[model samples]
Target: MRGLLTVCSAVLVTVLTVAGPVPAAKAAEPGGGDIGEALRHVPGLTVVDEAPAPDGYRFFRLTFTQPADHRDPDAGTFEQRFTLLHKDFSAPTVAYTSGYNVSAAPNRSEPTRIVGGNQLSMEYRYFTPSRPRQENWADQLTIWQAAADEHRAVQAFRALYPGKWLATGGSKGGMTATYFRRFFPHDVDGTIPYVAPNDVIDEIDSYNRFLSRVGDDPGCRTALKAIQRDTLKRRDEFGGLATADAAKKGYTFTTVGSLDKSLEIAVIDAYFAFWQYQKQSDCATVPKAGAPAAEVYAWFEKVESLTTYADQALAPYVPYYYQAAVQLGSPEAYDGYLRDLLRYPGADVPESFVPKSIERPPFDHFAMPDIDFWVRTQGRRLLFVYGSNDPWGAEPFRLGPGSRDSYRYFVPGGNHGANVAQLPPDEAAAATATIRRWAGLPPAGPEVTARSAPAGFPDFDADPIMTARPRL
Candidate 1:
């Protein structure tokens, strides 16, 4: 949810295909007996192509014709794209419930790598190749419908692979995985979701609180606010800079009209993105009061550029905005700080974010709230990972005292990229043990290594952020 650009960069332009050895032509259709037979027999499913993947695994691209609306069979069908990086039929499997289109790139799931198992990454319906005709968006985009699509994939794969199965995802993908387990509890043995937020409106309130309390020193928080305030206060100068930059780059802010409005949105996003991605050292770059307007503008660009929300940036994510407005609730941008300076008061509204060309369906607020309750009460064998400084961590699933099987690990000062291996030594070992036990595998070699921070950030352990929640 935080880095749509990073996620979209991995998408492939080609249609689905499987690249592997061809089986003998058969007169009769095969039944669900073996992996190959199951692929050939699964209704509305086809193996387009297959080829050799890294680590002695077979890579496959598949097309699954799923009903537009799972609750109603009469709603028709659409092609859902998925990929399988298969190691062995008997090895443990990790299924990635992608929040957006499943990229055709190599598998990067830590859980899959840590367990040394097969990986199945499925694209969410209504995204790119998996999307239906534009007219069908209203009926096709729903949490239950997406969950149903995953259930179909799991059912097909279970028949092919007899080893233990695990599900995991990050950000909205994590939320997608949680919804899958909620709908079909027996689908996977365990799930590990990273930085997944359960936002029920008022997301800005939590974000505001997070920004106010995040850094080790209060000066860092004050400095961030100063940059935001200065950018807005000098909109004429900064807006001109942004407008010139956009024109030079051939970028257009079609969703929010004028250059001034674009600057405002950029400023708002800069605050969120700064805390969402920046490291502690980056805080030193925040310009002082007397700094040139150009210097401040440069800092804004460094944190989050206005081009990120341009029409080009918004094109691939139209369906995501539609989903967020519908069942998947999104937070309203916090405008209280700059309320007086704002020109387009409605710019931060959930529906306002969707382009005028796309029709926005009425929002169903109850969908996520219902999901939050189900995961808390009945969900089991689930692990959640979050970054303490990350704003999205504000609305995590509420795990009460009785929720024994569910656990949450917060990486102190960690941003959205936080992972289980980044947890403290003792905590990481405990988490690894739980996952190994759940996958029915013995602890062996090839330990999971901690992830390095993105470019410009300090090394992960240089200034470690502690975990927020205790071990369960």
Candidate 2:
């Protein structure tokens, strides 16, 4: 029990608070260790499987899902054709990746719908690429590492149809989508990476900065303090996701990962440097006396340029990747592990400066390009979706190729996964129209709203009703 708590805690710093008292979780479903069986192809789409081919060439196969399917009145699991098949793309298929997190192993990325005479939920479960892993361990699991296991799935899809267009993933999946298209454009017709953070390095470091600003800047600090106080005071009213539900269900999120409010607050001390670098000193307020104003300002600007996407997104996700060091390690020990990550190789930052990207060296192991890099490189069509209320959605795309992310969609009140899932039926259907058109399929209805600019802080940069332009 102690070891179990330790593992869950490492996976989610606040999991301890949410570790709810509930029914025990069942063991994960079994599989052939072939993810290809999960991605089901459209019923009518002519499918194929691995046939004798060139020795060095990969072939895709068509597969089916018996568990991941479910029935619904609005949308039957197998009733409609939403391209939820396991097809190797003669052209490319959606990568459906996860985000920058510890996805090392014992993970489930796919969602199953209970459909016609089918088993319960089906998922794309993950395994630890490393050995000596823990039972119910949450560390060392990363979406990037999932690459080691994706070959069969990709090959299977490719063999199913050799020359189909592609639509890979969302968030982490988006990264894969962008990568596949950028690096292997000829493999698939094009890609739709979705909301994947291409600048993974920037996402993590930038988030740390964002959090620091929430604590450091007077206005942001005021907001944080106010939120903390309010949540604490009402406590019960806010639903206390961590303490109540997570704790009750034992769903993980209980671990504090070498931090409580106090420790997290302290960690934010160093995080300021990262933020200043990523935000280009926008996060800077009046400097303290230890560093001169000019020196501090100059130092920050240098950091900002390198505080690219990869730095921010991946840095925070690294510590958790080392499960033993995080879930089971002492708070002080975990804190040090985090510190060690800041010193990755080719890390160009000054001793006093932390690299704004991930604490690890950039691992383009797959040799894939990021979001915008693919857009510019392959001239791909995309449909970006995100929520306004999502804390992760706060950072509007900009600075690098992201400023142009506005070219996609900026949804209002959308948070993380909520953006796409929450779309009104008509609206979502329209977006699908845009995708089909991009995929070279005949449009089934009025073109879906390909790009939208909802009203918000940056305040609708341009009109949202415009149709997507054919590759210009």
lDDT winner: 1
Worst 10 residues of 2 by lDDT: 112-121
- Local distance difference test scores for all models: 0.69, 0.31
TM-score of each: 0.83, 0.39
Span of ten consecutive residues with least summed lDDT in model 1: 463-472
Best by TM-score: 1
Candidate 2 residue lDDT tens string, 60-125: 333221111111122211111111333222322443433222221211111110000010101122
Q: How many backbone clashes does candidate 1 have?
A: 9
**Runs in model 1 lying further than 4 Å from the true structure:** 1-43, 200-205, 289-298, 401-404, 444-446, 449-472
Give me the overall lDDT of model 1. 0.69
Residue-pair clashes per candidate, as listed?
9, 95
